[model samples]
Target: MRNRKTGFILVEALIVVACLVALMAMLAANQHSSMRETQDRLRQKRAESAARSAVAYVFSTLTSATPNSVTLNDNWAQLGGNGNQSFELGDLTFRVQIIDANSRLNVNVATAPQLQSLLVDQTMVDSLLDWRETSTTPRANGAKDEYYTGLETPYIAKLASLTTLEELLLIKGWTAQKLFTVQTDVIQSAITQTDTNNRQLPLIDYLTVDGGAPNTRANGSTKINLGVRGVTLNQIVQLGLTQAQATQVFNRIPFNSFQQLLGVPGLTPIAQQRLLDAVTFTAGNRVTGKINLNTAPSWVLQTIPNVTLDIANTIVTQQSTGFTGLSQLATLNGVSPTTLPRIADSFVVGSDTWIVRAYGKSGEIGTAIEATVVLTNGKLQIQKWDRLNTIGIPAWWNWEEEPTSTTAVGTGQ
Candidate 1:
């Protein structure tokens, strides 16, 4: 009986030892997890700092330099053409880029046909429009508050215009892959693509809320509204038009589009510039989504109502000399009298508003600053600034990207 008792005590001691070993293992795992969590938090904070600092740097640079116009070849876009110069704060790396905002499609004011050109399904396009309208009424293919509220997680439609591109993900059918880049197999199978490029530019690259500006001239002067009151023939002649050309264009009581006046036979560049400086079809001072013909890529150029892919390519080819005024546009081969009236109002030679994007990464985490910049009083001023966390780093940069449209610029602190 004593020997039996000894054996029982020995077994109890073994069980105790096993329990201690298990406890030690649990403690060790918990400590490791805690350390990982701490590291992640630190990295996040650093990323946030990096984003804000980059924005501040851009703001300061613009304020001091005060560029009047932002174009594709400007130093701001090139970052002094120095790709090696980058912000390196410990392990974080980033870059800063200035994009011509007007060189994109403005979804807020785009017509239904224009929206359809984005290759979005009619349902998604209708839903995107429904989300922006003030009313709760849903389109035939769109969702209102009801559909959104019935979702598993339960959310509401924005019921207003989007302030950021990130808000697109909240829309019914839009996804990160659709907005930023096309990288995943799931996306490849989901959306039927018409683009044949090895790497297609996403819809976000061609869309923006702040893509255009108020119908103001590059000189900050209000353009005369020929749609309401007619300017005198003297005013037309003073703009460098000959008496016959002036009378010919001026006889039209009210001009509808700049093309109506600009498309006159043999109008000089100076005359075209003056007509642009002095007239607009829009009566009121509302914002417009006129894409800059001087700086737009072929992708953005093709978004014009009647611009075919070949026409867009032709225009890009002629951009070597740059269109200082709309006069040069009429001289292009594809621009016919019949085509001029249809597309004249959609293009502009000068642009003021731009997108200043600062983005960077640390390990796998990414951050970005998207700012709407406008040139005011010969200085760059911030219109809207947004700091976005969890931004996906653009993949087209190193993937032999067609162009730098997808190149990510950022700053680090």
Candidate 2:
């Protein structure tokens, strides 16, 4: 009887031991799952915080002063030549870029000739035009509703301004692969010639449709008037001209319109184009779409009428200190008064719209955000905002290798 009782007790003990072991295993699994969830939540919070901080910092810088004053202060230089700047905040590291929208071609506003010069694809350019125009009639190489209706997932043509960059993917013959190939080729060629440190300049970098309506404030107010009585030498200097050229401009002042600046003594057609690219001369405090002379690449400068490659190169080389006025461009080697008028009205000393991209990372988890904002009448308004899966790091980052302390935390811009 005593042996039987001992056996039963032993069996019970074993059974209890097995149950405790199973419970321990289950608890351990639960703990691991909980830990993973916690880590993911922490990473997501960090990413959101980092993105908001970046936007706040950029907007503050943009609105700190007048648009031209911000450029004159050289604040945009903080973003670096390739538009990539990295910095650290708390436990998160961030890579940020601020792109002047005016530095890019406007799909809605660029002429056919200008689009041809930039895209080098007549058919694509024609398609782009057809997509935006209200008419159903196709251009020489463009597609219409009929072409779209034939697709596997048939849809009608947009016949309106593009609301988003992704809309390009829907255009006929604009495959994702083709678009990527073209953009990659263009960026590769540009970096090779310009030594842009192997930075990747995506297609979106060269194009935009946002900058607000030309000559109209975001608030619908009229632009500050520009004329002899309203204009000052200081304002003329903002045209990228030198003090001497500004003085000359002042002498030529009391002018009636922006067109009159083309006739300034010794102002070359190229210089005038540079001025046009950098300033707005119409009445009312309107913020027109104008390129920033301080930031535009030689290729972008070439988009101006009568601005040859050699002339563009001269402008780029002489822009070390950046242009405070359009007259400063006249000091370039080949720029004479004869060529300035042709390019006037294409540029502005300040930027009203900017594309800000920020990347945040913590350990293996990372997130990125891209935003387009416009500054008008001292107010900052966000036009577009999106989160990205990849941060688009440069080739030099060697992402295949293990991240280092500096790379993981990011270096200041």
How well is each residue in 125-163 modelled by candidate 2, as lDDT tens digits? 899899989998998899999999998999999998887
Steric collisions counted per model: 6, 48
Model 2, which residues run further than 4 Å from truth? 1-34, 69-73, 79-85, 178-195, 198-200, 212-284, 328-331, 336-338, 391-413
lDDT of 1 by residue, 1-413 (tens): 99999999999999999999999999999999999989887877777676666666666555533232334555455551222245665677555666777777777767767777664467768888988888888888888889988999899988877887678788887777767774343322132222324355556767787765446565446766667655787876876778987887776758667757666676666666567556677776444577877677777777677787778878878776566545556567887756765786887766667777766556666676677987665667788987664445344221221223322344321
TM-score: model 2 vs. ground truth: 0.70
Candidate 2 clashes: the total is 48
Give each prediction's root-mean-square deviation over alpha carbons: 5.6, 7.4
lDDT of each: 0.66, 0.63
**In model 1, how many backbone clashes occur?**
6
